[model samples]
Target: MIRAILLGLAALACLAGAAGLWLTRAHPVEAARFEGLTGDAEAGQTLFTAAGCASCHHAPDAEGDARLVLAGGQRFPSEFGTFVAPNISPDPDAGIGGWSLTDFASAVIRGVSPEGAHYYPAFPYTAYTRLEDQDVADLWAFLQTLPESDAQSIPHEVAFPFNIRRAVGAWKLLYLRNEWIRPAESTELERGRTLVEALAHCGECHTPRDALGGLRTGAWLAGAPNPSGDGTIPSLRPEDLDWSASDIAYYLESGFTPDFDSAGGHMAAVVANFAQLTAADREAVAAYVKALPPE
Candidate 1:
């Protein structure tokens, strides 16, 4: 009887190990989807700005033309830990200079690194997963045009099991749905949806998150506690904003509220970036925000 009990325990152990492996497997985007696609750097420039790539990857305090340099080392503190952004510059040794278009697309849209490891959600590839194929190709072309940086990536300051990058695969499995929060019936609204949901990743900040760090999709843009712990991120729902579409568009372009108060803190940089976009794009974003369900 004791021998049979030992054999049963061994069987359970093997089953548990198999379950773990299946749960943690990396699922990268297939390479075949990118065949024959050519990147357009000029078009990519617009997508890059909308995606806010430089906002996290650029050297802190870099000003003027220096902001274009992608020597990354910005620290973001969260419930998980402090996540240090990596150098995404064209440096052959320290950055992604050697990566192919497939490598880039997989990392951006699927959160799978070139080494076939899962990237932490701090990179925000969850929203980026919705990016159109051509947009990803265009962004790849634009990245190659940037100046190279030799800065080595700073490792994240996570503790225990959280530091295990493979564990992120489970997190992705739970949270990585590519569905849009809101549907659009018009072309302009569709453009706005792409900009808001895919490129801008606005929901990453505005939507509340669950205890395990998965976004609370039911809340959508109903505002969240600032991870920085200063205050709420402010709901973008129509009732909370209480502004006309034009008012929101003006705020995005000029950083000024309807009351004429200038935007401060992190929003200042966001306004600066949005200012580079076309007037119609800003209007579309505003229209989309106004169309959101009330909190």
Candidate 2:
């Protein structure tokens, strides 16, 4: 009787393990949602610039018009490992040229790849998952218009369990969220919220994370250690910034602070992107930043 009971317990444990794996598998979006959608390249350029796609995807040290080439060799050092951005140009072999709209949508919003594998959170799909389908479609259209590059993608330098792509599924189950961190109360705020929370993914840098790499939502945009080991990413809370809405807007456009200090380090690239936006859009972002509560 004792032997039989032990065997049953072992069988139950095996079943539980299998259930866990199944629960953590990649979850792609329904292809039906994009059925009638068409992309506008003009609008997509706006989204692409706002999203700062070139900052990480451009060839290392690329400047001027060369920045437009998304050859993808930028290295992002993190606690997990150094993640090499992948080639996202229009090359069918080296990039995403062959990807279908469903594949793109799933990769963008669900953090699932075309081959049904989970993408590491280094890609920041957690924030992107909140993006509207139409904006994603536009981005896709804009991507196709760019020059193709034959440059190959470099592999990420991760170790053991962290290197296992399948393991990311489990991580996603814990950290991935579709809900907005700061829901908007008005139409103007809504635009700013979408830009900051979804498209630009400001919180991906500013928000601190848990031991499991899950964002600490309770202290949203309260700042985090720079993943690249430079220094702390500063808090965007109103108390910390202490800038007027106009001041913030001006800084975003010109990269200058009220004290006349200019944006340096990675923020310079961000300022470059924001400068591409319309004056009204910059003000909207400023308003949103000014409205943030201290965490």
Candidate 3:
């Protein structure tokens, strides 16, 4: 009886070890190709604004209210747990000042950090992955140009298993698709598609969730409830609203809905970021999104 029990225990241990090995070994392949690209500070500025980096990381209550400051104390709550945004200022000790361009690219595109830990999807790297190599490099350069902050980042208050970074390898295996955006046959529309995929990240808030909390592919950008602890983010479905392409473009750039009311919730921040984009790019996003089939 003792021998049988020991044998069963050994088998379970072996199985667990094998699973762990499989999961961790699946770390994303290193693609340092982006390191060769020359970054444009001008383009980076636009991308930063389009990506809304300041909304979560900058200290909204700071004395000077500087948009460049990275106080790193904002808390984002979700179904899993609360994730505090980190300080990305040029601070070598407290922020990402020490990060190489490759490190930044990996975090934005592959969802892995400089410490080789997986960032929770709540960081929105899922949408960021669509960014082009040059854009990622430019954004990194722009971040490095910011004033470094001494404020340390707060740890995420996620529960067990969720706090374990190794488990995230499995999550990435299940949901992350490491592919570049392909251009369509239409030049104008294809440019719009690329801009939407990279900058607008429309799918992040609009797509429905799956059983494991991953985005549902077929329902991309159809509309989902906001997970940002504010009010619900409404559907962008054409059938749900009478908004035209120009109306959507105007709203994105100005935070006004078709009803002439000011936008609220997280979308207000998104519109604030969109406001910095060029009229042409904003129009591209509007055209693509408005053309999406109704849910």
Candidate 4:
């Protein structure tokens, strides 16, 4: 009887190990969609701005034209640990110059690396995963156009079990999906939805998370404590927003609300990115925000 019990336990352990391996397997997007698309560098620049790549990739003090230099040393403080952005310059030895277009797309859209490793979500691929294949292609082209910088990537400061990057595969299995989050009723709303849910990744800041740091899908974009763990990020629901579509657009464009209240704190940086976009884009984003359910 004792021998039988031990055998049963051993069999269960083997099953558990197999399950773990399967759950953590690398799953990449299909190449059929990403292949053969010629990217336009001019249009790619706009996408880059909308995606706010410079906000994280550029050196913290980079200003004006210097923002174009993608040396990538910005520090992000989080409960898991601090993440240092990587150098994405065109340097063959030190930057992403070694990366193939497929490699780039896989990393940006699937959160998987060329070596089949999962990337920490700090890179915002969760939101970027919403990007169309063509958009990813264009973003890749624009990144290639950036000047070469020989700066090596600063390593992440994650501690203990959190530092075990392989464990992130299970997290990806739970939270990562390539599909659109909600159905859209119109072209305007759809356009805005893509920006808010995808490139803008608004929920990364506004939405609360579970104990494991995954976004709380039920709450969606409802307010939560900031990732930095200080002040709270405001809810973007229609009721909480308290702004007309026009007001929201105006704020996005000029950082000024109907009452002339200027955007402050982290929103200031967000506003800076939005200001680079055309008037139509801002209006679309505003319209989408106004249409959300009052949560």
Candidate 5:
């Protein structure tokens, strides 16, 4: 009886040790690829708008050009909890002004902060993870040009276990891949794949996730229940859309379908972001979606 009891305790310890090892695994890809690359602030600014940095980081109700100041107080309500955006402005004290390009790139690309802690995926670094090294440098430089606000970062309100940021490392290990979730078919799709999967992060909203909050890549962009709102996020498979490439591109440009139906819900903000992209980029995205095999 004593021997059996001792073996049981030892087994439990081994199990706990293995679990800890899995949970603490890190995604430590090198950010030094951006090192020695000089960024063009003008180009970075364009990428910034494309990446929709202002959508969350901009101060509430900041209209027109005032959106350039990233004060980061916007609140995002989700099933997990309410998330508050953080300051990414250039202020040395309250913003990223003091951070090296390496520091900024590390967080944006790998979701690892300068302090080496795992950042909550709410920051959308998973999509940013696919950004080109040059783009990262340019984006960081452009961020430096933005006006800084000293607004205090608001804490995200989440329940127990979810509140533990360290656990995010495990989640990243499971879901945070830096490659295409769906295989690309043609060269034409390569550009759109980069835009849709990387900067736009359309899948982050459209793709259904498991209970653990990892994206259901098998469904790809087949839609999910909206986490921030009370409706379903419609799927984007070609059969789901059934529209020609021109139709998709036009809707992206004007937010109006060929049938005169307008974009609504969270898609309004997404449409606004798409409207800012170049005409060719919109066409490319539409082409990519049009080329998809319907589910």
Candidate 6:
């Protein structure tokens, strides 16, 4: 009887080991590449401003809005816990000066930093993944132009299993699409679709989250509760809004609603970014949102 019990325990241990191996396996995807270096620092600057990289990461109290200076210690409270945005400046020690272009691209597109660290979705890389490789490269170049700071990044204060960085590998496998936005031949709206998907990343905030905290695809851009504990993010569908697509476009560019209310909550920061965009890009985003079906 004793021998049988020992064998059963050993078999269970082997099964557990196998399960662990299966769970931890690295499923590598093809790395994205950009060719010919048409990346313009100017264009990248526009994209960066539109994306609102500074609103969350940069310390609000910093003297001037210099990207090189590390103004750490901004905390964002979420259901998972408080997440402090790290300094992305070119700081050799604390920031990303140590990163290569590939490393930077991985962080933006794959949500994994050079040191194999996983960034919380609060960093908004889900939307960022829609960016083209040239755009990503340009953003990298623009970042390099910033002065390097010496601010040490703070550790994330998330709870148990959520704190495990390797677990993000599972999250990526389930939700992230590695493909770039493809232009469809169907309509003039196709370019708008590409622009919205790659640049706007509307679904990140507006879509509902699944049990595993991934966005539910079928409900893309449908209004959902704010992750920042503020209030609900209202639907952008044309049916829901009493405004026209041009009105929406104007609002996005200028941060004013039809009622003359200023964009608030998380959207305030979003509008700040949008204010930096060109007239054409803002129109594309508005056109795409107006085309979305109502939730």
**What are the TM-scores, per candidate, against the unseen true structure?**
0.97, 0.97, 0.88, 0.95, 0.91, 0.85
The C-alpha stretches of model 3 lying farther than 4 A from their native spots are 1-16, 25-32, 62-65, 179-185
Cα lDDT of model 3 overall?
Answer: 0.76
- Name the lDDT value of residue 135 in candidate 4: 91
lDDT of each: 0.90, 0.90, 0.76, 0.87, 0.84, 0.72
lDDT ranking, best first: 1, 2, 4, 5, 3, 6
Number of the top-ranking candidate, with TM-score as the measure: 2
In candidate 4, which residue pairs clash? Answer: none
Please give, for residues 1-295, the per-residue lDDT of candidate 1 as tens digits: 9999999999999998889888888887788989779999999999999889998899989988888889999888898999999999999889999999999999999999999999989898999999889999999999999999999999989998798887898898899988888988788889899989999899988899999999999889889998877788988887777989999899999999999999876778788889999999999998898788775
Q: After superposition, how far is residue 39 of candidate 5 from its true place, in Å?
A: 1.4
Error of 5 at 133 (Å): 1.4
Mind giving the per-residue lDDT tens digits that candidate 3 earns over 222-286?
Answer: 67777875556566667766788889889988888778999877687788788877788778777
Select the stronger candidate by lDDT from 3 and 4: 4
Worst 10 residues of 5 by lDDT: 25-34
The digit string of per-residue lDDT tens for model 6 on 1-295 reads 9999999999999999888656644443235454345457777777677666766677655544663354466788878878887878888778888877777777887787665666677777777777778888888788777767677778779998888767776677677774543334445466566555655566667777888888876777667888887789887665666688778888988889888888887687777777777777677776766667665
